[model samples]
Target: MDKANQTIQITIDADSGIPIWLQLRNRLVYLISSGGFAPGDKLPTVRELAVSLGINYNTVSKVYQDIERDGYIASFRGRGTFVSDAYLKNEGSAENEADSLIDDFIRQCRELGIPRQEISALVERRLKLTE
Candidate 1:
C-alpha cells in the first residue's frame, strides 16, 4: 500500500517510556490542531491503521474512540472517520494559548539565567532556518 494514502502516521518510539496510545493521541491531536489534516479529512479505518503501524487493532480503535470523544474527530458507520468540523472552531483561542505558552517558556528560560540577548539570537537563528 502507498504510504502517502494513509492519513495517520504512527511510529513506535523505543526510547520513550510513554504508552503507545498516549503517543498516538498526542501526534494525532498535534497534526489536527496544526492543520496538517484539515476539517473533514478522512482517516484510515482502525484495522488498516493498525496493520500499517504494526500495532493491535484494539489499540488503534481505542485511540480513535478517545479522540472522537474529545470532539477532535467524528466517526460514522460505513462512511469512515473524519477530522471534526469543530477543529477550527476555537482557532483564535488556540493561537492565544500557544502565544501564552511561548511567553511562559521564555520567562522560565530567563528565570534559569538564560541571557535575553542569547535567547533573542537563538530565536532569530531558528526563524532564519525556517525561512
Candidate 2:
C-alpha cells in the first residue's frame, strides 16, 4: 500500500484513567507533530479506523472531529479526510506544541523527583538517538 493508505497502529487502554478517545487523539497529534502524517496525506476513514482498532465508530469520529478542529486534518466531500496544511502556514502552532509537550515532560519528571541535570542529559542522549 502507499504511505497514505498504510494502516497506522495506535494502542488504547479501555481501563486507563485517561479516556480512550483522548489516547487516540493524543497519539495522532504526536504522530503528526513527529512527521508521521504529511501535508495532504489521507487518513483512514472513521469507520475504517474504528474497525481496525476495534473501537466504537463514534469514538473515532469524535477524535477526528477534534483533530480537524485543531487544524490538523480536513475533510472534503467524496474526497475523504486529509492531513491539513494549516499547521504548515501556522508555523508557531507547531513549535509551540512541541515546546508545550517538552515543558509537560519536564514538569512530570520534576514531580517524580528527577533532577534537571539528569533530565537534560537524558534529553541530549535521546536527541542523539533520533539523529
Candidate 3:
C-alpha cells in the first residue's frame, strides 16, 4: 500500500447506518486534525479513491468537495488533491479550533438523526467519564 493508503485507515461500515460519504469525510477530518496527514500530503484522486473503496465516484467527489470547502484539503487541476495548510494555521487559535470541532460534531450528530437533548446527554455522560 502507498503512504496515503497506509496512513489513512478508513473503513466503510455499511451496516452502521452512517452514510459512506460522511464516514469517509469524518475520517479524513480526524486524520488531518490528528496529524495522520501533514500539510501538502497528496491524497488519492477522487476516481482512485472511489475505485479503491468500491463506492460510487460521485460519493468520493462529494466528500472531497465538501472537505475542500471546509479548508481541510485543496485540489489542483492535473496535479491532484493535497492536504491544505489552512488546517495547520487554524491550529494557532486553539479555542476557535475547538469550537469549530464541537460544531462539526454536533452537525454530524444531527445529520445522523440524533436529537439535541440526546446529544447533550451524551456529551454530559462522556464528560463525566473523563472526570
Candidate 4:
C-alpha cells in the first residue's frame, strides 16, 4: 500500500451538525469504499489526523477506535492503522461497480421520497464538487 508517503485529503465540516468524529469516520469509510484508498493502505496517525483537523488528539483516536471496532479499519501497533480488507470493494470493472453503487443509492433515495430529478441534481452536484 505504501501509504507512508501518500497524501490523503479529508474535508471537514465544523458546522455540519454532525459530530466531528462521526463525520471523519464516515469520510474514511467512503474513502475506503470509493477506492480512494486500498485495503491495507496506512492511514494518518491519530495525532496527525487530529492536528490536521484542528481537533483534540483523543477525538481522532476515538474515531479510529470506533471505526476499527466497526471492521472498517484495523490498527497494527508497530505498523500503524490501515483500511481493513473487509471493507474492500470487489476488484472488477470500476464503472460497473460505480453503477451498482449509484443504483443502490438511488433506490434508497426513492424510498426516502427523494424524486428522481432531485436525486439527479444532488448526485451531479456532489459528483462535481466532491469527486
lDDT of 2 by residue, 38-103 (tens): 878888889988998899999999889878877889989899998886755556676777875687
**What lDDT does each candidate get?**
0.76, 0.80, 0.84, 0.75
Best by TM-score: 3
Q: Count residue pairs with overlapping backbones in model 2.
A: 0
- In the predicted model 4, the residue pairs found to clash are none
- Which parts of model 2 have CA positions greater than 4 angstroms off? 1-8, 89-131
Ranking by TM-score: 3, 2, 1, 4
TM-score (C-alpha, index-matched) for candidate 4: 0.60
In candidate 1, what residue range of length 10 has the lowest lDDT sum?
A: 1-10
Instruction: Find the number of clashing residue pairs for candidate 4.
Output: 0
Error of 1 at 102 (Å): 19
The worst-scoring run of ten residues by lDDT in candidate 4 lies at 1-10
TM-score of each: 0.62, 0.64, 0.68, 0.60
Write down the TM-score for model 2: 0.64
For the record, the alpha-carbon RMSD of candidate 1 to the native fold, in angstroms, is 8.7
Question: What's the lDDT for residue 12 in model 3?
Answer: 83
lDDT of 4 by residue, 1-131 (tens): 44543434676788887667667877777777777778778889899888777888987888788668656789999999888876444445687558755765786688679998999999889889975
lDDT of 3: 0.84
- State the lDDT at 64 in candidate 3: 93
